[model samples]
Target: MELPEPDTASDDAMDSFLDKFQSQPYRGGFHKDQWEEEFEKIPLFMKKAPSEIDPKKNPDLACLQSIIFDEERSPEEQARTYKGEGNDYFKEKDYKKAVISYTEGLKKKCADPDLNAVLYTNRAAAQYYLGNFRSALNDVTAARKLKPCHLKAIVRGALCHLELRNYVEAVNWCDEGLQIDATEKKLLEMRAKADKLKRTEQRDIRKAKSKEKKEQNQNEAVLQAIKVYFEDEDRAELYQVSPKSTLLQVLQHPRYSVKALTPAFLVCVGSSAFCRNYFRGRKVHQVK
Candidate 1:
């Protein structure tokens, strides 16, 4: 199919190019008589392959696309084409487009385990590059399910786990991978890093538990040492108490009426019947 001439730099350049194009006789070498090939050499025709065909604007590009995407191709063949397209985008570092292409390949349901696994793994790589660690992890899981022991998927899954700070899981995944290939340096390194982080996390948890236990013990001791007293006007007198279970015993002591206190001992009857009937049972709690 024929493509239009390349656009020129300016009006003057366009007029000059037209004059030269019209006046010159055919002396083509490599692209002799191949108009599409010659037009492609202009860096304008199909330089960026159209994602969708538009024959009106880019007939050559559209024709190229139509030829490549005929109905004769099977689902598996189309899927493999998408996979190759994704790989090309990946090599160019166009990760977002690569992910789109890979996702399309997966949607084909090619019924080819190897192809599907590779598609998932490739899409996972693209997702990882985009900083979608959880999504990348999910893709790796799908890839692994399709083909267990897929080394690239295992490596990518471990990386995602590490990024998500699932330290223990990262270590376990690395270990699983190492079991498949003990000489894998990437797995060995990841395992070492994950194991160290997991150990640190465990140590920090243990330290926090110990500190909490110590504080609790100290608070309990303080509660045990608090002395009970009964105040009569401004004169305070000690109330009988035991070292252990002092508050419990005092609250649960045999019935004692606040009004029955000796004149020297003063106790106000509380508003509530339960509170007035029981010895003052409110606890002023303090925890360290």
Candidate 2:
């Protein structure tokens, strides 16, 4: 859903309120005759809608700003009031409101850059709770960009990446964030989980490969053992290999010792001598 454009009516209304105070000695645009009437009106208007607040109607901002910003209120009182508002919303888990309260309370106007980072981080967390992942990610990114070392924003950004199922990105973010807050337990856990998942996947592939290799090796070993046990290992090797004059040369070339025999000689002796004699003897005696 699209949000409505910001209403300018409040600011426009404020302009009219300020015009009446231009030549006034005090704010609230109240003259001597109007003071009592305006005093009675403030309490009634304070109970009305917040967005409807107009200095012209009730003059709370003017009065409050005067007391809060003026040298009138003790510094401690001013601080207590600001902290009270911020703490109220913070305890209520209204982080967006708390952030605004805290921001407005910063007495040092030059401190806004740091304050903005805190506000952005708080609102990002609230957005995350509201299931606005993209908005949360944007706020965190902005906060980090403003203050690159913001540990909260970095951790939150990594968590958002995890929620989004961008595991690689999540791991990368956590890795970078860990540099800033090395003791961040949550980030460590997230990176550990991602690492475990990656290792598990690799283990599965390795297991599959090992199973295939085992099957292949078993089949090869069985074939070799079968040839040796039944088919006369010698004769099978002789048939598989060509026996040329090189065989006779290697076998009778007495210059070479039998232990030094080539693989061709071993095959010829193992297959031919035993198997050929047995077969020929069996055939000759079988004449009928």
* lDDT against the true structure, each candidate: 0.77, 0.63
Candidate 2 shows a clash count of 2
Cα error of candidate 1 at position 104, Å: 0.4
The regions of model 1 sitting more than 4 angstroms off are: 1-55, 222-288
Best by lDDT: 1
- How high is the lDDT of residue 126 in model 1? 96
Candidate 2, residues 1-288, lDDT tens digits: the string is 999887799988888778866756564467788776665566555433243346777566667656655656654455455556666676777766665565555453334465656656766776777677777798889888779989898888888887776667778888988998889998899998866765776788899999999999998766543321112233332222222334444444323334344332222233445646644533111101
Which lDDT tens digits does candidate 1 get at residues 1-288?
899776656877889988998899657655657776657643254465656655776666666667766658887998899999999999989999999999988888888998999999999999999999999999999999999999999999999999999999999899889889999999999999998998999999999999999999999877654443333322222343444544444544443224454323223323446534444553322111
User: What are the clashing pairs of model 1?
Assistant: none
True lDDT of residue 120, candidate 2: 65
- In candidate 2, stretches whose alpha carbon ends up further than 4 angstroms from where it belongs are 1-87, 95-111, 197-288
* Worst ten in a row by lDDT for model 2: 279-288
Clashes per candidate (backbone, < 3 Å): 0, 2
**Prediction 1 TM-score vs. true:** 0.63
lDDT for residue 20 in candidate 1, whole number 0-100: 96
Q: Model 1, poorest ten-residue lDDT window?
A: 229-238
Task: Tell me the RMSD of model 1 versus the true structure.
Answer: 12.8
